[model samples]
Target chain A: MTTRTPFDIPAHASSDDPRVTLDEALGTFEPIPPYPPRTEREAEFYTLRDGEMFVNMGPQHPSTHGVLRIVLKIDGENVVDLDPVLGYLHRGVEKLCENADYHQAICYTDPLEYISSLFCEWSPVIAFEKLLDVQVPRRAEYIRVLSGELNRIASHALFMGWFALDLGGLTPILWSFIERDEIVEMLAALTGQRMLFNYFRIGGVNGDLNHEFMSRLGTWMSKATHQIDSNNALLNENEIFVRRARGLGVIDTATALNMCMTGPNLRATGVPFDVRRAHPYSIYPELDFDIPSRTEGDCLARYLLRMDEIKQSLRIIDQCLHEMPDGPVMAKMPRLIRPRPGRAYAAVEGPRGQYSTYAISDGTDQPYRMRIHDPSFVHLQAVGLLTPGNLIADTMAIMASLDPVMGGVDK
Target chain B: MDRALRRRLEARFGEELTGPVRQRHDETEIRIAPGDLPEVMLALHDEPDLRFRLLSDLAGVDTGTTMQTVYHLWSDSSADWLRVIADGLSRDDPRVPSVTFLWKGAEWMEREAYDMFGITFEGNRDLRRIYMPPDYTSFPLRKDFFLPDDASRSPGGGVRPMEQTHGPTNAETAAHVRQASSS
Candidate 1:
């Protein structure tokens, strides 16, 4: 048998290059004999040989948390090849956005990234604001920060809960949901919905936070802090949790940077890149909080970083509640938003990572085009790199650690 | 690496730069010709101060007459965001060069653009249906694509609500209650 090396293509190649043909380039690397035809006597033509095992993980598995099917080729206990098949829960959200009005489209954004619904809403809302040249009021900015932080805490809690669930612990999922429910209730009071809160408008928020909501939030924040501390002591101190997660999905700083992984996943690799601190949108410049980072780029490090981020989010929320100025929740925007013929992009440090929106307004009330930059979408790319050369069991651990809400992925 | 670098880019890529490279209302937008997209993107990615190595998003916009593609690139090292706009192509022939080779993150974004706007990328592989079904007809995002209207549907073709009787007998009411309870 003759083996060939992987083909190396230049970064920039001219259109006239003879090696542009995909078949010719790939053919040079390997030559495998064609498969024999299936016979009537044979039950199946594609049966696995003695050592090879082919397993279909799920379009309905618990670890994925959504309809994501992964076809794994295993050699003994180690995974040799993993091909991710998508489109199981495809709802054609982008196509639906095209038909929906700019304001009405906010309803779909929340569902796009169900885990971090607020950030999804923020992306489109902020983009619309930029396209229309509308400045949000100070009170609205404070309210936006408060809501965004609450959503962040909620998302991280779900991640922590789900990560523990993947590692075979049932208690943390229940414990995490308690904090998540409180935050969701606080958000529901302002937005009038629980899961997909379409509360952010182009110019500012949809409405103001009431006194009762603020008081309840203050109480929930203190209770959540105590619960998180106690929960951490219970879970973080467990020897099994530590052993499975400590260095299972170790990604170095260079690979993390190259892969474009963001949010807590990237921060866990020791690169203190928080878009809130870096870009500083929506009164984030004034808010004081630490950008959490960990030297170990592993599953445990990401878990620790997310926990720290939740604390930091609490600090930001407390500050916003204290310093929130009394004013109109929304700015004076035109009845019909007909922006000049130009394109603009707005990004925020979402619960997942850097959620961005690129909108093109061509002198019309409706956006000419809209593109959402989901952090989970980019972070999911690192999964293939991390999972290879690891055992099948460890693969689930790494995927859970990444915390990719597949709605964001398949959107 | 600062103001000087912007000036150098402006001078070297003259009309290719399109408009003045400046922030408008706290957001930065840089326009370039379709052909100049790869060069401008490379320069933005390579420049020390403007190390926008990550192509955060790539989306297409239709202006009724033409289609425009926007690229949002961000640098993790610098925490800087740069919005690059390429001139629109005709709706009939929406073709653009792919940037997957430079940044692998553009793989899904470009596929999304293709799926929604019917804009074809020259070098992208595995460009089959993304969010929509493989057999779905017509681009749903286009302004002209209309949703199915019940008013326009032929008589008896549209879904109609089940007719209800004003008064119900004891047996009929009991049957309804039983059905509801079972459901």
Candidate 2:
């Protein structure tokens, strides 16, 4: 009997063995190398000081959000440096979009940020609409904002739960998930699916606000702010939650801007830059809401900022409901979609940050190139910058505060 | 479109620009040579009137003949998104300067562009592949890149499922599975 190793072939086996070439091929797919460091970053990360050691948080660790592996270089409990090893959940969505037609490409983008899939669909749809020079009806624009804000609220609810759960609290996740479930259910009625809703299309949204969705939103809105306040009351003053998150992973404004952070993370640093406000797309210019910000730039500040933004989102939703113009939801369009050969960049301020898509058309049905700029990808880089001096325990807390969904990060 | 901002850009980079500045919708685009990226980017970042501090996005494009790196910038100076297209890079070895000096955030975006299109950022210290595994050789987003199943990728292979550039063969996978179940 041959001693078995992972994808190993017996050393004494003849070269003519059928498995020889296959085994050699399998060897290259090894996730970790049995060999030494190959690149400069790998060498730097692998090398350790006398008392320091490397700890892998996960591609499987519960706190990583999704299949994200963070390599932490630690001396005692203090993280000396960290490297984020990504591509674990990479679906090659951009490459896939290049092969698919414009309308079909929106469906491909739906799962990039699974928590806020509507925003994922929104950017690409807007870009395609720009390429086609299609003017969507006013009612459709309002519905997009209405449904998008609902998704944002749901996402923030989940973020609150996950953030609290990461800091050794259990109750908040349940509360947040319950809130998130209600929103998801409401969204399912509006769209067809619970998650990864391919609701946004090139011309407009898939459907108008139906009775089921309207009823759910009306019920949820009456007590939404109160429920959020009650759930936040559980952690907003709790000593452990505050102590763990407060003043931990502090990033200042200049450093935050230099890191290209947007959304809540940048807002927590007092930038006041929301893509919806700064670069107005859709009917956001018609809506009135403040871009809530905090000066501290700590994990606590980030958490608190999202809680505040939930109110702002609710305000936007309320305004969207009251001011929704009566018209057709989708515009008249041809059967086949082929945008003119040009480039379009469209971004929306999602719950996470700026979810943008840059689409280049070559007068063909399929996009010549489609690049998705996810906020998670930009914010994940800042983790390496933020975690160097912090303790190991605070690593997850810091990451949770940033709220990086690995789907978006890896896409 | 902001014509003044377009005019200002033309006046500033008229000589260095490869093509005329084009403004459409809410975007103003400029085509520049690869050599002028760093100089132009520096001016856009530092100039008091045109302080485009925010690096909104960086994208890579393959025009079938030439490779291009597109950068989108947002600033209070201009209402429109300023796009700088570093055009006409050699397809054989597409190399452009990195913008990490101005926005440290451009590092990963540049790395991704390099990973997908093989466009090397000359000044990026950490120019490793971001998405593809370290052993991957071919740039996936290149116009010529073909899947293993595609006839053009491996001619006369009869669509061999496991004969991809990075994946193992069926026999090897089965062997691994058998070994795993026993363990």
Candidate 3:
């Protein structure tokens, strides 16, 4: 064994060649031969047929959205099989939450899905509240619904851009970003951050809606639907975009349910099984909104389903604003919360489907075990099932349509 | 809580359950022995009146004494989220049946549970580490993993475990060196 000190400057520290150690670490990246297969699964995945070959795509590729690497076994251009290699971004968020106090634990989950951090924060906050059995004030619940809907619109806006960009269109991303930026700025005015907004607190939100947020929301709500529709017209009817996406990666409803797929991806397959409508939680039963669904179950269907859902979110936000309640935002709770020894499971309808948290408290300040079930992790697993019969080019299209953020996948 | 759903679960599997069916808030849970996992899961999936088609979440928990594999199921037949816990598995050799035959997507969640808590799913074909390095020996999420202690004795630390074992300096000195580095 070799010995080293923490402060030691290695032999290559001053060397201009950065690629020297990296080259040694990369070591061909071949499936099997130098490194023997450790499990039956590895052996099966690595055993390529005579006409088939493996193509390694992005732990760094642009279309991957985050640092997700997928190894594809291809026969010419058609993909025979694909295996997703995760953990490039794993930070052990569950373990971290176990170590942290209940209130502080919300910070760890904030970055799990960077694009939809509000939903990420909402699940755990609600779970912790359930464990403590605190009833949040009605106004706070309304604020959560309002801001969460705004965040969902922002998340879907980014999704529209990324989906079109993956299909080789550049202008749609620019248009979508402008729309996304407006909502993001409004959220920043409401909460204090743009990206990983740790705004959701246990039993309520961090603060009530401010004047700037309301003014911005009022301005944006008037023309938001028209802007999104005008931006979508660039690719919604285009022959190339529609043809490329329409029939690609079609997953039937039964298969989707069997795979435990949730959110818009499953809705695209014609089952309107949304957590909000099915299992009503946190002011959703009071809100008047429809769970938009599509029957095609293709990449195009998934893309269009999200577009329909965004209009529904705007409607929900409008209703929340009109029916704003008069009460304090926060519930009565201890500063150092010690929930009773029990378990609680809370799920919210996120932009990516059911973002849920299962917490087991040992009647202590810290959770005994906090199990976070990210939909991206579950949705990404079905990629191997969906991409087998399609071409290698269509793999990225299917993945983009499914929209698995790597942060959530690797958490 | 849905009292009818709880009654349906109790009537269906009263003999198989290890404990009373627990209902709290919007959740209902049942605990069963590890041996009864496959049959119970099959009945939950196949029976028309109790068709819990959607497997919402699967997680493994190490409660310092024994291991548990928990399954959260969502179905239209029930109004509450049904949580089925396969409890009382020996921590040294925790083994449970794979639910992949029912929900193929559970293959990954089972892999993740195995990766974190070292619980083995007997019939899972792809039972490899989902998050950790392939050669990693210790499970990170196990109760006895002791992360902070292991982090102090990491390879790059000035006071190596080897030095504490054989060198003239005592274990306290090694701990001191770790603190010095952390500072």
Candidate 4:
């Protein structure tokens, strides 16, 4: 396969055009009012005069999930200011998409949101199919749903594992992975890749599920559910876990709605705002499930909501397997997919939140411009809001509850 | 609520929702003049039927000659989405008004557009680089931007030599080896 080198601009380009350069522009750009100075003495001399310790929380910390650094200003325990420094994992996915073809681009999307790779694949593929108005067969939709649900389970499993690890429980992480490995194996059998599965094509999936794969998947699903139930029972009943999680980083429904938070985080705030139920896509309307929500709007509520959602996902997967029709997995698609000049935005309920792909195609095989609206990007905003009044010790727990996958956030 | 709100939005926004407006696949686009974006967006949020409270995403597309800023706005109350496009920003001055004042989520979205597309948000609080390094040079997303080839630069210019071992295998080397006489 042919591969092009990543684009790199000359260092002197900024010197030639200072307006386009961030450093040059920021040199003269005034800092926001009520700013603190760089050094301790300088900061003390400033208006807010309270002695606050400045600590950088990442660029290396384990809770970040990837390369993410947050420069935080703390007054004793409460955070006064937070500046998230990104780009440590910025592989220039957008720039790469520009050069890659529509089919080739799907490979890149999976890696962007590594945790919910299926949702990432689903959003772009569905967007491409919509742009082209390709009619995917019934079987394809069922397969898509099956894979999507399995992906959701895997994603939530990872979240539960990491969340338990964050809470200083190691055994749950290992147990959660026991199910994750089965799901990954199923995905690999279908898609040929484990982590970054570029299985979804424009019109339909890359291929059909074999009978042997289906039986194996069915066997794994039963065991996974029992494991999920036992794990939830273990974590939920612990008094220390409840004390640390319940009522910590409490956010009301109003704030969540105002901020446009989606997925489990918004549901935890007592708003049944799941994209699957509200704006049904990929035969989700035909499925049997309820949007799990909690009225407490706290860390524990969010955790419980995710646990319950996993059960709902399992229900969807079972329904998909039972009712899955036999037909063509891939719809009839043109060799070159050239859509009419227009734009479309297709969003799916990703593990983190609402993952949307907005594609603008000027009647070409490749999109004119594709913009991805990752939920983690918006969820990161909630971090600054929730951490301000909480203790430094609670920062990791609050962040873990949010489950901000740096891949999605940075991409 | 769904059908009535869309109609009310179309009526209130008048010509703003008319001609040159197109729908493809799942995305809907309503083209508006650059000067009219603020008024159109304000009406979209204010209208009872189309309470698009959240500005989900804002991005700039460089179409060679001109730039088009696309806004993806969603309503949590209604579960509907509206994509508004404002086209025709001059290459020299790619400035657009900040929507962060309306939706708090637009704070970083605008910063990202500014960083990648060099689209200036007139009143954005943080306009620094969001994805690229602080000292990054050109806007890499533009069509004219090209990745420099290591071998093209002069050796004494402090330009690092191309690491021949990395990246895609060179086709020219294979061609040269094939052309060589049998030894």
Candidate 5:
């Protein structure tokens, strides 16, 4: 209920203390030289004549998305060397979770990846349930898949808007939100929250979908198809959009996997490694859907993959609607949840990427420590690897395709 | 963990297996001495059978006794997930060899571990704080760190103090509100 942000602990009591410098604050962690190859690709395409011109692209800029600041060394328009400076939006979500108990901690994960907050909300709940060995009923499992896929469609719609916004197309984003808002509204009806729906409980959901929600969802599906069509019409085949994003910011399979890029970003690089299919959590294994991927691994492929994924999410939603069982949504929970002294890891294919949570319980009501393995934190690593050779203009396009939510990246 | 990979790791690090490779809630954890962390991780990455090329996550835990570093690894080929735990370091100097050389994805994660738990990842190229500012003196995630208000954070407690620390006490507020309504 409070408006205060976490990670608000001041680094310095006052700025006057010259002795308390940023370098002096480092306990033992040190930054070493010979950083990853500044520009590893062909020099003729994106190299600069000189590497002296360094520019900070973010910490506030819109194109970088969120508060990410990339220190770009330029030669004319060519980027020579780059270093992504993060932590601007750090809210200490991981540190805050340990102090709260099992049920209380689920809400804290909402803002961590707010694009499809239902997905982010599910990771910790899944982890806690796994640790405690709680089994959700069959009906609740179907509800989870129902909410998750709807959230994915909503998230991808927003991505379509923002990605086009990055590429200088305004109308597409406005149109994308028309469909996204309806899906989000449908979710809000189920969860009682408009934006950060902390709806997923340890064993089940906060409540079941009402009759009105199902009726509205049935109507919204037809409208959502038109919204997806508008985005493709605006940006997919357009001459300028394709020319700009076709070959820009291409990453190979080895580098993408090595960087631990998950979700659509990893899938675009031609690796069919979806956590839903590969790991098979919740009701995902029961449902049938394809993990659409592209071999090109460029900005266009990344953008197109998300668009295709929206359709796949719709397919999942269609199945959930047709075969959703009628039963209790809330599972029976113990008065005090005390999972044994062990650790549990659970992941959901979040809108941003593979959002996973590792919860360690020391046989107490409270978790000893909880770590969020956010995909954006790992996916952001590709920024430094992807940016050095491309033009400064293409930077926004590359960053847009990555689709990082600051909550997860800085959590 | 797959049966074959567990045997290979146990065979490779004969006595250094701190304990039996224990299964914690379906996931297997391979505990290694702090000294043998880098070696075990290298073999996990390079050895043909277990290619845990993807470093999913790296985190630090304050176990009341010592600071423990946990590494979660994933194999793309087999979809096998493994947890490699490096234990045995006091709070004063939690030094463990950095695995930045093995997985490039570990750079920021290790930096974050160092940032939160003050665990020193020796030889990590960029060990700057990933979440907190570089100048932050306290390790916020450590078990001992607590805000003054954190003591009173328990739910459904009786006779709770008012949140306004610098204002009138609750009794004073009640009196003031009564006076205003009467006036």
Candidate 6:
């Protein structure tokens, strides 16, 4: 039994080194004061009518995704106002990245959007690469497109499952997980880890798609269409599902743009703006794909748009496989990757929305600033704005429709 | 295209331009004094030619010498991405006017700016901390306010978990969660 006390310092540990011991360093930082006493009442954000009351929804509810607490001020089943209290999942990721090396930070991004972590990791990788001006080979671009589209399918598939599950169904999620697990397994074959595959490197992807990966992808592509068709046949045609989803929580273009919602949620509002087409990052310009959008701007519209995206993603993957060029995946780089002191904003079309990263390097191996434009974080705010007038039960459907993963929201 | 933007912005907000309109390889941004932010942003939003309607992203950075708040704007019609840097905010008392009135997107972003950099947006109505607990005094994003035994140290890795130096998260919980699953 070898249990070591933290106080047992090594003999070689120097008293001279400030980092070695606590020694007055603990006093430097001000401690966070505890929240207020139970008796003291804070001013209500919403003035409730005489009979109205406030309902506290989960900080740990299944429906809110992950530890998302929403306080709804309701007046007879109709929500008068709602406030989203965030920060349950915050780990000071930005602060940690500021201290870690540019390349070392890629590992930290995996947990940020665990569902579609590849897309989450893509923004920072491309942003850091842009600042360094590293030239990714054409082959690497094709691989990225292939893997990214597959990952997108996996993400939206998971969404398809959960979106239905949240609306009181289990079978859709069962169908979703089957396809999702297969995709994850194939991804593991390509990238080593299942979820949060830190596969993207400073220059390019960590590795190339093997023959096994290619053949597996070929098999999965055909199967994916069947799965999509099955899911569409199962859910979209269901009158009950359609009634639950359609014409509920519609956001107009002006309001959607103002609130800064992105991806399918924004596209649902009739804006034909996809960052892939709009920004022209990677080899998306060369790839033949259409930006699928919906004019309805409701829960069903958003749902259908995501379904449409899966078909488009498959199209992109097919093109990448057919038009793939042969070359090295990684770009040549200096031993220590220290980009020059400058700023760059690079964006990728995340499964949910615009997963943008803003990188500022200060001539050090570490980045000065790495700010993420998390789509879920922005989308969560819509809960406050849009949820006010809707029915209390509809909040889940509306939130589910937005496709929020707390990894992105609370990062 | 950037040359024309430089000319147009230069002709409009001449003296307000803190540095030369820096049009980098990937990003295009015009640096302006913090006081000139409202005027420039309003002009950028309302202008027919330069219709930067969407406030895509806003972030604050502490660059050793000074703190800067950067805004990324996307114009729908023209398909142009623009970066606007509002620099020279006091590290001690960083403040900028809230753009919430202009664009509702700035509401949460401005709160985030306040939470991370202590950069108060003057006109923002709901300027409470978004990520961190309301009581947390120190701004986590600043270069100086570090977690205990940060990994940058050359000596060794941190033996103990982190203390409550940053935001709502403390190291005790982190340590407990990281322990072996079997036990």
**Highest DockQ among the candidates is held by which one?**
3
Q: What is the C-alpha lDDT profile of model 1 across A1-411, one tens digit per residue?
A: 234223555657665764543443342311111434223212131345578766777778878779987766678898766656567777766656644668777787779987678888887888788767788899999998999899999999988899999999999999899888988888888888888888888888888887767777978877878888987886789999998899888998877766667788889998898888877788999989999999899999999899999899989988998898998999887666677766567788987788887766656565556667777777776776788788998888999998888998887
lDDT-better candidate, 3 vs 6:
3
Q: How many residue pairs clash in each candidate?
A: 0, 1, 1, 2, 1, 0
Tens digits of per-residue lDDT for model 5 on A1-411?
233322343665465654333433334322222233322231222344544565777677887668887777788898776777678888888767877888888898898877878887888898899888888987898998988888888888888888888989888888888888888888888888878998888888888788768877988887767767866888777898889888888998888877778889988999987888877788887888998989999999999999999889889988988888888887799868988777788777877777788888878787878898888788777777887878887778888888877777888
Q: What is the lDDT of residue B116 in candidate 3?
A: 89
lDDT, candidate 4, B1-183, per-residue tens: 245445555667677653444443334457787777778878777777677766667778877666668888776555456678787776556777777666666777877887777787776666767887665556766554533442232244343322222111111122111111110
> Which lDDT values do the candidates have, in the order given?
0.73, 0.86, 0.87, 0.75, 0.77, 0.81
DockQ, candidate 5, vs. native dimer: 0.21
What is the C-alpha lDDT profile of model 2 across B1-183, one tens digit per residue? 999998899899989898888888999999899999999999999999999988989998876666799999999888899999999887677889999998899999999998888888988878888887877876777665544534433345444443233221111211111010100
**Model 2, A124-202: lDDT tens per residue?**
9888988899999999999999999999999999999999989999999999999999999999999989998999877
Candidate 6 — which pairs collide? none
Per-prediction TM-score of chain B? 0.70, 0.81, 0.81, 0.70, 0.76, 0.79
DockQ of 1: 0.16
TM-score of every candidate relative to the true structure? 0.81, 0.90, 0.91, 0.84, 0.85, 0.88
Which stretches in model 4 have alpha-carbon errors above 4 Å?
Answer: A1-48, B1-6, B15-20, B24-27, B76-80, B148-183
Q: Measured by C-alpha RMSD in angstroms, how accurate is candidate 3? A: 6.8
Query: Model 2 shows how many backbone clashes?
Result: 1
Higher-DockQ candidate of 2 and 4: 2
| Real contacts retained, model 1 | 0.37
Deviation from native of the Cα of residue A264 in model 6, angstroms = 0.8
lDDT score for residue B12 of model 5: 80
**Over the stretch A1-411, how does candidate 4's per-residue lDDT look in tens digits?**
233222344545554563333432232312222444433423432334367766778788898778888767778777776677788887777766655668888888889888678889888888888777788888999999999888889888888888878877888789889878889888888888888988888888988997767877978876877788898887889888888898898999878866668889988988787778777888999998999899999999989999999999899999998999999989887677777766678888888888888876776566767788788888887887788777776778888899888888888
Better candidate number, 3 or 6, judged by DockQ: 3
Model 6, residue A165: displacement in angstroms?
1.1
- Angstrom error of the Cα, residue A397, model 2: value is 0.6
